[model samples]
Target: MAQFDVSLVLPDTLYHGSTMGAIQGLRIKPINKEFWKDAKDFGAGFYTTIDLFQATTWARKPVVAMERLNKGTDPSAMVRSLPKDQIPVVAVYDCNSNLYTDNIILHDYRGESRAWAQFILSHRHSSTVDNCLCLNEFGWIHPHIACGLMADNDTGQIIEDFRSQGRDIHNRDDLEWFWTQIIRTREGRRLNGLELGDQIAFSAKL
Candidate 1:
C-alpha cells in the first residue's frame, strides 16, 4: 500500500482501468457522464492509480455496478449496453518523473482536508455539460494534474443517503462540509482494508 502523492514525483509506472480496450495513447477528456454520475474526486482527466489492484477493480466497474444494482443482474445486459467489442482493461503506463518539474501545474490535495473536500464540491457542482468548469476561464486554470483520494463510493450508498435525506448533492459548500464531517468515518473503513485507493488525474497530454 504505497501512498500516492501528486505533490511529490510520481512513480515510474501507473495503471488505468476502464471498459475501453487497449488505447494507442492517452488523451484528455471531459469528466464522463458515468452510470453513477457521482462527482469525480479530481475533475475530468486521465485517471491512473499507484495500485494495480485498484485499477483492476475499476476495470470491472461496469459489471460491478450491475452486480450491485441487483442480486442477479445480467452480465450480457451490461455487455450489450457498452460500445461494441468493449472489454474490461487495465492499461499500464510508463511515467517520466522528470515531467513533473516546476513548469508543470498541479493541484495536489493531501489527506482528507476541508479544502480538498471543497475542491471536490466545486468541480462537482460545475460538472454538468453546459457548465463544465474545466471549459471556462473562471475555473482554476485547470491544473495539468489533480490528485486526491479515489473513494467516494466505499459503501456504494453515499449518493443514496443524500437522496434519502433530501440533501442537495450539487450545493458546493454544503457538500464540502458534509464530506469533511464524514471523512473520518471513511478513514476507518480503509483501516479495515476496504479502501477505494488513490488516483492521480492528468489534464495535460503529458
Candidate 2:
C-alpha cells in the first residue's frame, strides 16, 4: 500500500490552535446532507485531495462566497479573487492505499462510459434521501474508502453555468472531458475512517 498525504484548509475559527488539535477535538465532520444534494460529482463525504493547491481552492470557496454575498456581489465571480487569509488552517492526513483497497468500496468513475456520466448527472440533483442512500451504501460496502470524480475549476464553472440556466445538462461530451481531466489530474479519494490519530501533520495560522 502506497502512503499518501491529503490536506484541507479550513477556517481558522474552527480550532483553538492547530489543525491536528481541531481534528482531535472532533471538529472535522462530513459535509451535511442538504449541501450534498446539489453537490457536483461525488455525493457527500469528508472530501480531500492529494494536491495542496486543490485543497486550498476548495477551502477558499465557501469563505469567499460568503464574503461576496455579504458585500452584495456575485459570489461565483468573486471566488477566484478571494484571499487565502479567508481560510487559515491547513489539515494534512497520512493514508495507506491498503486502507482503501479492500477496506472500502471504491467507486471508480474514471472511465469513458456514458452510464457513469449519466449516473453522476442524475444524482447531482437527486433528493437528499437518494444522495444519503448512495453515501450510506458506500458505508455499508467498505465504510472507509469513498472515491469519485474530483471536479476541477473549469468543470465546476460549467456545471454552475448550466444550473443557473435551470438546465440539467447531462451532455456526455462535457462529462467525459471533465471526468477524464479530473481523474488524470486529481484522483478523488476520501478517507472515510479519518480520525484524530490518523492525521500525520497539520498547519494553522491561528
Candidate 3:
C-alpha cells in the first residue's frame, strides 16, 4: 500500500473559546472539559469531529452552531466549545484516500492498479509526484508503483470506452496524455494486459 501524509488547517484566530462561552451564557451545562482539553492538546481528531458534535446532549445548540459555521457566521456557539485561539495540530501517518468502483479488476496487481488509477483520477492528485527523488534518478517512481497489473493493449482504451458509455471517468485527459507520452517516448513499454481486457470486456458488456 502507498503511504501518505494527511493534514488540516483551522484559522488560528477563529472564535473557538467564544462558542464555548456562548454555551455557558445559556446556562447549558458546560461540555466535558476533556473534549476541550483534547482539542487544546491535540487540535481536532479527524475521526472524532462529527462524533464529538453528535454526542453533545444539546442538539439544537450544536446544530445552530454548525449552521452558523456553514453560513459563514462569525464566532458561533459551537466554535466556543472548541479550542479557539490555538490551532490544533495532528500528524497523521500512512494516510490514504483511495476508492474503488464496480467493474474494476480486483485480482492480482490489477486490483492495485485500479486503486492507483482511481487515486490519480482525483482532481487533487499531485502532478509533481514522480518515480525518483533526486540526482541519480534512482527509485524515481514511487517504489510502490501501483501501475496496475501488466496490461496488453493501450491503457487509454479503457478510459475511452468508459467515456463512450457516458460515465464520467476521472483524470481521463491527464492519464490519456500521460500514457500517450509514455508510449510515444518509450521504445518498447506497453500498456497493461488486463487493462486492454478491461476495455474489451467493457465494450462487450456494455
TM-score for all predictions?
0.65, 0.43, 0.18
lDDT of 3 by residue, 152-197 (tens): 2333454445556555534566555434432321345554443222
Question: Per-residue lDDT tens digits of candidate 1, residues 69-145?
Answer: 86676777776677743667788878886754456677776676666665665565445322446535245566777
Candidate 1, superposed: residue stretches over 4 Å from native: 1-7, 20-39, 69-84, 99-102, 128-139, 154-177, 180-196
Comparison by TM-score, 1 against 2, better one: 1
Instruction: Report the alpha-carbon TM-score of model 1 versus the true structure.
Output: 0.65
The C-alpha local distance difference test score for the whole of candidate 2 amounts to 0.40
How do all the candidates rank in terms of TM-score, highest first?
Answer: 1, 2, 3
Question: lDDT of each model, Cα atoms only?
Answer: 0.61, 0.40, 0.30
Task: Give candidate 2's root-mean-square deviation (CA, Å).
Answer: 11.6
lDDT digits (tens) for residues 1-206 of candidate 2: 56545442322221111222234333443233332324545443345555565455555556655775689766655644555434334555544444322322344443434544444444454423233344333233322333434333344555565567566434656655544543332334321221101111111100
lDDT ranking, high to low:
1, 2, 3
Evaluated at residue 75, the lDDT of candidate 2 is 63
User: Which pairs of residues clash in candidate 1, taking residues 3 or more apart in a chain or in different chains?
Assistant: none
